[model samples]
Structures are given as C-alpha cells and as structure tokens.
Target chain A: MLSFSEENYLKAIYHIEQLQTEGASTNTVAKKMQTKASSVTDMLQKLADKRLVVYKKYQGALLSAKGKKIAASVIRKHRLWETFLVNKLNFSWDEVHDIAEQLEHIKSEKLIDSLDAFLEFPRVDPHGDPIPDKDGNMTKQKKVMLSTLKENQQSKLVTIKDSSDNFLRYLDKKQIAIGNTIKVIAIEPFDKSIQVQIEGREFMITEEVAENLLVEIPSLTLPKVKRTN
Target chain B: MLSFSEENYLKAIYHIEQLQTEGASTNTVAKKMQTKASSVTDMLQKLADKRLVVYKKYQGALLSAKGKKIAASVIRKHRLWETFLVNKLNFSWDEVHDIAEQLEHIKSEKLIDSLDAFLEFPRVDPHGDPIPDKDGNMTKQKKVMLSTLKENQQSKLVTIKDSSDNFLRYLDKKQIAIGNTIKVIAIEPFDKSIQVQIEGREFMITEEVAENLLVEIPSLTLPKVKRTN
Candidate 1:
C-alpha cells in the first residue's frame, strides 16, 4: 500500500521508539537512518499528516497504531525470510540478515502467507526474534537479560536482541540456538562476567554479551535422569 | 528495475519475437497479454521509445537485443523463485507459478543472487524450463512434441511449452514430472489417442493432451536414483 522507502521510514521510526522509553528524537532517527535531519523532518511531517506517526517539530516521532502494524508486518516478512534462509537454504545465521533485509520489502501478502505455511509457521527467526502474526501481534515472551540471572541459577536461551552479523557468527560458533538450555554455574566477581553451561559444555560470557542475550527461567519439571538405565 | 507489468510486457514481446519468422503482430500480442489491442499499441510505443522494442505500426514489434537481455534477466528471476518455492517452500509444482510471477518483479540484485546460491544454482525450474545464467545466456534444448512421437518409441518428458497453472495441475494429477521415462505403446487410429507407459503404469492420452506435452526422443538420463546392493 505504501512505497518501499516510506515503509523503511516507518520501520526505522518504530525501532527507534522501541529502544527508547519515551518518544523517538529526530536526531536519533536521522542517525539510525543514516540520512540528513532535514530529510527526516520532511518525511516525518508527511507521516504525521498521514496519521501514521505523531510528530512535533525538533522532537522525534512515534508510530501510530496503523504505523506500528505496518512496521510489524515488515518485520514479520524479514524474520520469515531469515528463518527460510537458515533452515532451508543452508545459509549461516550471520549470512542471512542482509539478504532478508531486502526480501522483507517484497510486497505480496500471498507470498508471505504461503511462506509462513511452508516454513511450518515458525514463531521465531534464526536470531530468536519473534515472527509477528498476520494481525501484527508479536509472540510475547517473559524473557530477561542473561546478566539478570542469579548465580547458580539455570535458564534457557530464548532469543538475542542484536542483529549484528558478527554477533550471530559468534552464536553459531558457540553452538547456541533458540532452544538451548543454559546453566549459570558461577559469576566472576572481578568483571561481573559469568560462566554458563550449555549442552554439557561450559563457556564464559562477558557482561555485555550476557546483557544482549535473552533467557527464560525454566519451570519446575521432572528430575533429570542421572545414570540412565 | 521496472514495474512488474512492464517486465511482463518485455518478456511477452521477447517470446513472441522468438516464435515468428519475422516480427510479432500487435493483435497476437494483445491476445497473448489478454489486453485490448489499443492497450498493446500504447505500451508498444512506450517500449519502442525506451529502446526495448522495435515497433512499426501495421507490422509488429521485435525485442531489441537490450530488450531480450532484460527479458532473460526477468525469466532468470522467475525460474529461480519457482525453484525456491517448489524445492524449499514445499509448494507443489502446480502451486508455484503465481507466486513466482509476483516474486519475479522484486528489484533486488542481491536477493536474486542469494536465491541462486540458496537453490544451489539450479539449471532449471521444476517444470524443466531452463533458467538463464548470470549473464542472461539461456541453455538451448531441442524441443519435441509428444504428438510427434512414433508408436512404440520411447522418450523422456522434458519441458512443457505452456506453463499454465491448469496444465501443471493436470500433469500433477497424472503423476507426470520432468525426466520421467515414457513409451508410446499404442495409438488408436480412429481418434489418434495414444497409450503410454511410465514406470510400468499405462495411461491413455488424448490428442489434445499429447500436443501440449513436450518430450525428447530416446529420453535422457533418469533423474531417479537406483538402489545399489
């Protein structure tokens, strides 16, 4: 319904809004979009007139409900393409983001629906980002920063917030995935880094890395089978 | 690089030019595009000015070499998307054409490149239509109509000249696919209908169906794998 460039603006604005507690600023948006402040201002005014964004001069913009819906739809396409690339095309998680970025702009509802069906309606992409539903509802989860976990507490890696290719490559090298279980074995007092266990193997994670990693506390379940029959 | 409608027009003109000994007529193009002759005339003038078509009123239009290159590029994108849909997306052979038709219009060189890599550089789509290479060079194949096959002679299913969804669905229901070995066991003299055997299963084929089905004499190597003891 909208131009690709306009959709990109909305998606960028939406992401800026998500990162901040309040409204997004014009400077921040310009920085995020790698465009001049004047251009962003011009587009923001247009979006405000369209009721897709709430904008005030010198201040940033927040997406209206309709704007948020469009952003989420674009994100849904992005994540679905990423999942398809990783799962079916044998592309490394790190290698898929740029390609999926372009594919997300392909404007066909039927293509996305068939893709969602073909990918078995995956809830998340390779990066653990939720794939939005058809109605633009995100797959909400009660996840916390890995750094927030207490010492000796165990959890599972559910998602990662960073989309940097280097970070994804690191995850691939670590053999960590969406469903991987992680145990918080110890905390290093000097640097606030932690030692965690995954798949019976242990690795040390820095505070910065842990903060970017999303984790879910496991519910109580049947005891582990030690010394199996 | 162009609108989907424009790319489709270029492809139509390219194919039409390939068919005729000389140039392609406007009426024929109008019929092929399912549009009014007036619309065809309008588009032809536009394409001619763009240097993509050589048009002369009351005669016909021929694709310029540049036009053919653009058409081949579009065909490359179309077949690549088809392979991706059918092979990776689990779309049936009958279900991919429409989706590919839309996907072919996405104007991202990187997306197509990634898709080509994703599909392992398939030489053809599921329908056995040759996918043009990176430089827009299409692999040529000898065409043979099923109606031309002699009784008791064997051949292999190759490409279908007509790729209509209805035709593909019919083939799917009959368990027909590219590279399947077939032998014309008998032909009824009265109506010119033939009986063909595939994988030891015999099927009666009507004259109309035979004319639509394309094959190659003596067949080619079987695509199926033989078990080894």
Candidate 2:
C-alpha cells in the first residue's frame, strides 16, 4: 500500500511530465510539492526501488506504467468527488476542489465505483476536466484557449486550467461558466488581453486569464428564415 | 490538526471511559487499540500535554472537554458516512464499516455538513447506532438487551453492540437485522440459549448473541372489537 505522501509524489511527477514532455526534474517536483530538491531526490530513489518510476541521477525522473496507473486513479477519485460535491451536494464549482483533494485519498475501489455510479457517471468534473475511468482511461476532448478564438467567433467555455479560488471567483464575478456562450469581441494587441461578451454582457480579461480558459467551437447550424412568398 | 492515529486513540479512550465510568486505564486503552500498554501510556502523556486528556501516572486517563468534542465529531463523521454508504450507495449494512472508517478522517466541516443535509439528517446509521449531531450531542434512546425480554414478549431489534464482521455475518445468516420484530418463545436453563420467533420463523440464539442484541418494546394499542346488534 502506498502512503499518502508517496501517492502525492507520484501525482506531482505525473502532472509535471504532462507539461515538460520529457522526464520531470527533481527541482521541478520540489517546486510543485513545495519541498527541498534533496528530499525529492530521496523520494525518487525510493520510488525507483519500488518500480514506480525510472530515476536518473541528473536527467530527471519518469513515471513507470505502475506509477501512471496509480496517479490516474487518484485523479479519477478527485474529479468524481468534485462532481459529487457540486452536482449532488449543491457546492459551487469554486468550493469543491479543496474538499475533493482531501477526499481523493480514501482507499476503497468499491467506494469510488459506487460514487461514480451514484453521480450518474459524470464525463467531466465541475471544472469541465474529464474524469478518468476506473481503469485510468481518460476520454480526451478537443479544446483551445479562449484567446485563440478569432474576432466575432463564438464558442462555449469548456474547461479552466487553473482552478485557483481567486481565478474561479473572478469568473464567477464575470458570470462566466462552463457551457456559457461567449463571443470574442476584440483583442488588444498591446497586452494580448481579450474582450468577450457572455449573456449580453461584455468584459475584458487579462491575457493570462484568457490563456487559462479553454473553449470549444460551436457546431454550425443554419438559421431559420421567414417565408417571403 | 490532529493526526489520524491521535484521533483513533482519543476515540478508544472515549469508548473505554463509557464502559469503565470513571476513567480509561492504560491497560484498557491498550487492549481496545490492540497496542502495547507502554505505547498507550506515552500517548496519554502526549494527550495530556496537549490538554486533550488528563493523565495521572499509574492511574487512568480521562478526556478533557475538548477531546470529547473531537471524538464525538469523529464518531459523527463515521456514522454519517455509514448511513450514506448503505442508504445512497446501496451497500449492505455489513460492508460499510471499513469504508466509513477511512472516510471519517477526512477533515472538512463543509463537506460533512453538506453530506448530512444530503442524507436528510439521518439520526441513526445502518447499524442502528445513533449519529452525533453537529454539536456532538447524541439522542438517547431506551433499549434493553434481547436476553432481558420475557417469554412471549415482542420487541424490535434496535441496535447491535458488537459490530464485528463475523458477528454481523452470523446475524445475516440467521436473517436477523435491525428493525426485525422478534418474540421470545422459550429459554434453555442449561446453557441460557433463547428461542425466538421472527416473522413466524423460530430460531435459537446463544446467550452471548442475545446479550449483544438491543431491542425496543413496541407501544401497545387497544384492539377494536365488533359490537353485536
């Protein structure tokens, strides 16, 4: 059985690998975990001994198949719990992440499976991030940053990369949320900030915020026309 | 900020105090926690230092008001989770204790409050154990041991004192459960085993089993009689 600390290390390594593509460096893991590099190195060696990761002295570390599986399972639990908090318990999307973090460590496969079924097998969490299935398989969706949309183009908010409380509060204040139709009104080339309209309200968001917001293009459908005959 | 092990020790001490009625001895706590007496002594001292318990050398330890509050909160979480597992997740009564044990350590006041509302403020868990409220108060109920019921007396099973898996399985095999109305038919003087009728089916249970089962007497209502004209 993995200790909570060990499981957290594995999750950090998995997430760092997603951004870096190459193996995750000890310094990177340390930064993500807010620990010392030496401590991360010690943990990496332990994980390597357990066959959970492949660690090199200086080239960084990569999660083995076993490590990835555990990481994905933990993510699955976290997302499913977030979905339960928001959809069933009436918690807002901004308030569920911290609670779900603590709940993700509960170690019962039957409990998680039952929870997933009880939540009606939600495809994504309240943040619009896909939930990994029981076997650690994720259903991928095509999404682009809100800043990437052209002027006058319309799309629906699909996901938010940074789910920090402050960012979520900002979105809440702007009345922007998942599945809300947004039109890109203009872009400020000076700072790359974008002006968008949602629910007949217009707002300008910072470049960083726009980059963190993912959007999905709406499918095309012909508009109904009045009969002129 | 109590560790899980510390919380478990507090709960054990609280339970032992209930039985002893004075204070919880190191030996008794050790036996209840399945640990060494020396370890229990060390923990008691630490708890005393933290003002969670009052420990006297070679005597027994008693939980401070703060400690009792925390222990009751943990119990509340455990019973509430068990209620959710059995009522919402469709788990059998016998299968929820271990899962709830893990869940009880999750430290989030909002989560528990939301879950309590979601479960509609269940007063008792699947085992018929009263759930502590937010203020750490449990509703007192009048219950008597099954062995205390007289011959031909009918009562409903209200609680099971011993929740061990083996004991629960024994009850399951006998088709006995909480809320089952049982009528005492006879008692064997030799070994003190009692014969009971449930749903018109007769079965004999040993004195030990009878002592562990708690029952409540049903309120009597006058029977209507047809009038002759």
Report the C-alpha lDDT of model 1 over B10-80, residue by residue, as the tens digit: 98887777666577788988998999999999998988999998998887789888888999999999999
Which residue pairs show collisions in model 2?
Answer: none
Candidate 1 docking band: incorrect
Model 1's alpha-carbon lDDT is: 0.84
What TM-score would every model get versus the actual structure?
0.65, 0.93
lDDT of 1 at A112: 92
RMSD over all Cα atoms, model 1: 9.1
- Fnat values, candidates in order: 0.17, 0.74
Range of the 10 consecutive residues with the lowest summed lDDT in candidate 1 chain B: B217-226
Tens digits of lDDT, candidate 2, B1-229: 9999899999998888866689999899999999999999889999999999999999989999999999999999999999999999999888999988889999999999999999999999999989999988998677888998776678889999899999999999999989899888888989989999987899899999999999985455423446697
Name the candidate that leads on DockQ: 2
